[model samples]
Target: MEEVEVVVAHRDCATLRVGAVFLKIDSDQSRTEVEVRAMALAPIPTPEIRWREPPVLALAALPGRALGRLGHPETASSAAWVAAGATIRKLHDAPLPPFPERSRADLAAEVDGECAWLLANDVLPAEVVTRNRELADPALRPWTPVFIHGDLQVSHIFVADDEVTGVIDWTEAARGDAHYDIATLTLGHQTRLDDVLTGYGPGLDPDVIRAWWSLRCLRGIRWLIEHGFDPSLPGGEIDILKSRM
Candidate 1:
């Protein structure tokens, strides 16, 4: 008998895998709707949807391994990271998501709210949060919007033999800053950023990318804690923020 593996089980959603099939259960059907719609529109490789019944979505698993994950050392080759970048460029150059344009104000407020919570809760030293807040400011400025993955965390991207195999978890897909995806891809692996940029083409600002790193880690610390994830793990978000000092 094949054992069922629980990939992730948060209050908002849960993913289970049995054999080559993944079962996604979400409390909010709208997210599933977005995932389905985004996959259909994305130009890159995505898992095939086997079935969709309210609250449960079945998908065929892709063949490759995730590029890397947060709080862990990256093991993928430079070529693979570059390939991942090329794959993202393809998606960004594709047509928009057809959904209402996302609000930049809302994104700023969310970051501000998280920073406030970090201070109020004494989550970290004041200097660390304050400094990163200043560093994260550039990300607030407007720019040309593209269809973004919203959460292109390294683990969501898979690669094999120096090529991108697939990208998963499209619930947060929306029209937003393209660099957000680039920043997310290089979250803990900033050293490999040059390789990603090599395949992503030009016109990206490093200052903006650095700012987003602060914004994402600062904003994400709250959710990671609330959802029972440790952001303080050696190379995790906490360290990422402190290093900004």
Candidate 2:
């Protein structure tokens, strides 16, 4: 019998791994459309599309292991992290996808909303949330947008030896602040950042990246909690917020 594993299940979407194929079932058809389109536009390797019908997108799993899980140490070599960075550089250099506009003001409002939820729910201590909010203020400044993966979590990247084999999950892909991708990649694995930056080349502002780190952590906590995932997991969302202080 072929093994069938549920990768994740939520009101918005569910992902399943069966044998060598993965099935993504999204409640929103538009998100699936954007994902398929983004994968086609990315300059780097992405999962091969097997079939698409309505809300279900079947993809052939890519070669190699994931770079790492979120909120955990990455066992992949520093070179692999560097290669991942180079892959992102290539994607950012590609033609921008025609996604809807994303504004810093919109992001600030979202952050403010999520932060409010966190405090009201007591998801994180007030001081932690307040400090990270202050840190995130700098990232609210204007930036030159680029083609970004939108959700460049480490698990989305796959690697073999020292090369990036493919990147998965493009639903959130958009033309947005470049630091968003960079910050997403190095969210919990700060130690691997030097290697990634080396391959990403120069002129990236450290403050912006740091600020995005705080912003993403704060922005994601409420959603994760509402979705039934525990953000309090060790080295998870809460840890990411504390690390920014």
RMSD values, in order shown = 0.9, 1.0
Please, what are the lDDT tens digits per residue for candidate 1 over residues 1-245?
98999999988899999999999999999999999999999999999999999999999998889999987887999999999989999988998887666677887898889999999999999999999999999998988889899899999998889889899999999988888999998998889889999999997888899899999999999999999888999888999999989
lDDT of 2 at 173: 87
> Lowest summed lDDT over 10 consecutive residues: which window, candidate 1?
98-107
Candidate 2, residue 203: the lDDT equals: 61
For each candidate in the order shown, give its overall lDDT on alpha carbons. Answer: 0.92, 0.89
lDDT of 1: 0.92
The true-versus-predicted C-alpha distance at residue 4 of model 1, in Å, is 0.5
Which stretch of 10 consecutive residues in model 2 shows the poorest summed lDDT?
70-79
Stretches of candidate 1 exceeding 4 Å from the true structure: none
